[model samples]
Target chain A: MADTQRPLSPHLQVYRWQVQMVSSILHRATGIALAVGSLLVVCGLLHLAAGEESFNYFKSLIGSPVGLVLLVGWSWALFYHLCNGIRHLVQDVGLGYGIPQFVRSSWLSVAGSIVLTVLVWAYVLTPGGAA
Target chain B: MSAKDVVVKDRRNPLKVARGLGSSQSGVGHWWTQRLTAVALVLLGVWFVVTVLCLLHADYATARATVAKPWNALLLIAFVLTMFWHAVLGLQVVIEDYVHVRWKEVVLLVAIKFLAVLGALASVLAVLRIALTP
Candidate 1:
């Protein structure tokens, strides 16, 4: 057969945005984000091991504005991935295949993550909390 | 015709030919490990978040003392190792699915593995240093 260029099947642009799609995409997006966040973990460990001076520097860096932003983003990402990942693991075992259930769970993942993030930040900002 | 005298040609479409023949035999292992590590992470990740939160405003010596504790040090090591393992597996799938260029895909996959391994080792070493030293 002759080689030919063929238009690919309808892509993301062709689909109407929906919760299910958003949840699916966010799972991957947050997964990627958390993967990058893993580097921060290594840095913290190394600095802690290095001694008081290095550890103090690492602490201040993460306490800065930019670091707080990244921390907040990663905390949300972690929660979202955690919630959605559990949903996925459940689905893998043959439950929640119904469309309505799937949609509900998708929304649950999003809502749950937001709530967790807010609660965490609230605690962090509270006096005598993580701050 | 005698078997030696006749050749059977595979005339199926390329897609059909490739169907069910694409398994490199390691895919299942990769998938299973990813899930297993994920399960581990769920527990470890929560523990880690709480631990860090507890140390939020702790001074350097206090933070060092907490990490130097036996159980915290052990779980911290486990958490970092599993985290990098899970991250590598997840990144590998993302690269495979999205990076269409053959060479770029291979380079990324290799690069991610090397980085994850180095990161994991560094974390383990650091954890050991914290745990072992006074």
Candidate 2:
């Protein structure tokens, strides 16, 4: 609560949204989601460690419909963060500062995340391997 | 020693040298650690996703076997440990930056650490039990 009141200056609404902004916003958004998702990871570990019966319960819980949905969401979030994080690292080295470069890189991050996710799922869905 | 120290100081403004001492976070240690863990995750995460994806259509035994593989077990443990560690580091910065309520912040920080540790330990041990027992 502000003790002194003043007319709030016109803010974020005034600016045009850009890809960098979108990715930047999404990065934080995804980070928060992943943080929450970490709890499931914890549960999985605890179940696995406790022994086969307990771990079986954990497995069943995850194999449920709701668990599948949460997993899909978190998988996307993790991939998005991974791709965007690499992009930010590149930018840290003083590359991709140009407006065009910045915008394109944002798309690259998004595309890369989707592509990676697809590749992973594709490999997973294959007949042998882990299946 | 005095002459050497005086000569170094004389070369630049004392402020310039002194500035490094403050919490400016100049080194790449944190940044590098974050990126390094990220790079590891890209590989581990993809592997993990693939592992889970395969398990998606599999029965309980199949899924359990997949996790019980030597490579899968080791990587799974590594992935969980590194991920939680990275998360704590990330959250610590976020909490410190915000969370002006000092006592609340302290409790939250401690809680986060405890949870991460508990999570990592459980995951690793789980992987071990599965992999080692059969």
Candidate 3:
């Protein structure tokens, strides 16, 4: 198999980076991240059911620096995936097929996700807001 | 035409040849279900975020009580199930597309399903415990 070199179709390295590409790639990446993050949900529920001590411990763990960092990352990932996923759903319905519309929607997904993420963090950081 | 001239060359039926070669007729089901779950998650995800935010700084007892509420428990269970279902479907597509090695791909696909199923089950059980207990 090593002896015969076959010409492979162009992939990531071959194409110039564009918003469409970035949006498509990030959708998958964030999806995978969120999939892994689902485990955190399971852990939270389990601890809550266990007892007060366990619940507090779980809260503290998530409140720690590293956990906070991960939480932020997952928050952004969630927003990004949600926005881009909606874009995909719209495309599936046969809208936004033109090149200009396509490019515009791609940027919309990126910008929308960022704005949403910022809004979420702003709320979390404000007084009386949850982490 | 003569009967002999019209004899089929392939012994196996057409369905046999097509069985493993193309979609098992489940591809559309998978794609449709993924979209359906995505739609469900949009509502549930927003509800979950708002609910958690409302519980901000709540003590353990308050948090537990909130979760034990009827609507909260029902929605949480729905969210957990839908999220896992959507995650598994998305991950399956990713694994199938990227993992080239047959054995590795099969192992990963199966592993993710197992993990998602267990995670969903555990979350549901935990919610039930919270909802059922005083």
What local lDDT score does residue A120 receive in model 1, on the 0 to 100 scale? 92
lDDT of 1 at B111: 99
TM-score of each predicted structure versus truth = 0.90, 0.75, 0.90
- The ten-residue window of minimal lDDT in model 3 chain A covers A1-10
Model 3, global lDDT: 0.92
Top-scoring candidate (lDDT): 3
Task: Write candidate 2's Cα lDDT for B63-108 as tens digits.
Answer: 6787788888888988898888778777776676556667878998
Off by over 4 Å in 3: A1-10, A129-131, B1-16
C-alpha lDDT of residue A87 in model 3:
91
Candidate 1 per-residue lDDT over residues A80-127, each given as its tens digit: 999999999899889999999999999999999999999999999998
Tens digits of per-residue lDDT, candidate 3, B1-134, equal: 78886796788888888895547868988999999999999999989988987887889999999999999999999999999999999999988877766788999999999999999999999999999999
Model 1, residue A84: distance off in Å is: 0.5
Local distance difference test scores for all models: 0.91, 0.77, 0.92
Clashing pairs in 3: none
Error of 3 at B27 (Å): 0.7
